[model samples]
Target: MSWMLILIYACVFALTCGFSYWALTGLMPSGMTQRLDSLKDTPHFVLTEPSARWQRWRDKLQRALSWLGPLSSATEPEDASHTFSSRLRFYNAGIHSHLAPLVYLASKTVLTFALPSIAIGVLWYSQVSLSQAPGMALVLVFAMLGYYLPNAILAHRVARYQQALFNAFPDALDLMRVCVQAGLGLDAAIDRVGHEMHLSCPELSNEFELTGLELRAGASRADALRHLSARIGLEDVEALVVMLIQADMLGTSVHESLQVHSESLRTKRRLLAEETAAKLPIKLLIPLVFCVFPALLTVLLGPAVISVHEILAPTAQGA
Candidate 1:
């Protein structure tokens, strides 16, 4: 038994498990911490200052992986950061961090080797090498699964976040329309809507609120709208962004554009609701067939089958 190899394997396994567990079961910030994320807050300052032993270690590990962000971009210099960076993906999933890409890249690196190391160690322990078909196949399968698992998790996160945003957007849009009709500017309407939606739809509210901040900070309306669409990564939002941009450029009525867009979004939302309702029966059928129907058949036929068996068995035995 090689102690060094065993130690390396253990380290890799620990790192992989820690990252995956953290990604799946995220740390929940308190309500006040989440809402007020400023550096002056108690929790934020505590995390910022390396007073705790764990904080010091975490900061060291983060510095080690921080290089991967630039490495990811350097690997695809011709493309935009959003094209090659996991930043947009993380943003859409509500993970706003400069270190997210680094963590993601490090996870891929660890997982790419972690499973294969375990498999190869097992093969070696069994006196088999990768030259053999079974060993090679096992290593390949583990490696592929390791590499793709992060991607699947990210997609699931994005899907769930997007669903929440989609469900919440209509009401926010209606509020924006009302504000616009009341003679408020688009920026003011966005700010008011975001502030109003704090209780109902915080995620979308945060995005809208950020957009309004960018507007107040003197960013162009088009740029701010595009940022909103990119952060959301939703087709409906992209469409709205395009419409708003076009309206702004053409000097058309922003309220009219919003009104029409709001109605279209409502129609789409209703249709999506109908589609989901239609899918309910099909989704329920599998459980009915496999679970419910078996119990139902057992209840309905068990007594009859038992009676017939009793009657026929006695006659057959007597005869």
Candidate 2:
């Protein structure tokens, strides 16, 4: 029995390790970490000597968890030592990051332990009278619900944040264009737009601010934009970054590029609006017939039905 338990523990451990590897490797696209390499130059507070030692410890743990593999050894040119620290800080922040996954992991662990323990205790208390364990069935259902409900909520929040970022991005680009055309450098334009957009789209604003800081701190503008695209994980942002990088490499006019991108983004927004408008009738049909149409019919025909019933009933009685 002891050997059986040992084997089971070893199997569980191996399975867990395999799962961790897969998760770390598979969560993001192929070039994600390369893109995040830009965070090295963003302005952040320096650690004291003691703090630095503590940070090194934290970073080791993060690297293990980050599953950076070969990428972990690669350093950013600008702020080589501080790069990992900044990324760790970003991960800890509440802005649509991976805390949800950690929460889910902890919750599942607790539920896995708690559900069976509770079920066994209740069953023992009842003296195990019922065969097939009705209590066990209830416990299983509740456990499934408890597990899935939080996941569903997290999925919704993540989706909403992604959509919000996607919707806010083109506007951010336009703002950047305005600032650039006003004679500001790209970094300055980014900072201005980021500050202005804080109230409306705090997430995008924060990311832009980070990008501007990276650019100012000696990271190339193209590198910073690439990092921004990775952080947001949106195709539009990626395309914009690519466009900006190409313009930089070719020594084309930044102002003209920004203008063209702004126009293209506006057209995209128009198409999205049309698509949503097209969906409205389909989305509204259920409520329109079941809710609105029934109410309208009651309002319009109720009195006439009552009048006909009254007139016909008396005439039939006379006959």
- The local distance difference test score of each candidate is 0.82, 0.69
Residue-level lDDT of model 2, residues 5-98, one tens digit each, is 5336546976999999899989856543543454366443333355787779766655544543223224324374665443433332325444
> Residue by residue across 35-147, what tens digits does model 1's lDDT show?
66653434421224445987787788899887654553454455576564557888899788666777887777678789899889877886776786766877887899787
lDDT of 1 at 49: 42
* Candidate 2, position 173, lDDT: 76
Number of colliding residue pairs in each model: 0, 0
Question: What TM-score would you give candidate 2 relative to the actual structure?
Answer: 0.56
Error of 2 at 98 (Å): 8.2
- Alpha carbon deviation, residue 192, candidate 1 (Å): 2.3
Please list the residue runs of candidate 1 whose C-alpha ends up more than 4 Å from where it truly belongs after superposition.
Answer: 1-58, 66-85, 116-139, 306-319
Q: What is the C-alpha RMSD of each candidate to the true structure, in Å?
A: 7.3, 14.4
Worst 10 residues of 1 by lDDT: 41-50
Superposed by TM-score, candidate 1 places the C-alpha of residue 269 at a distance from the truth, in angstroms, of: 0.7
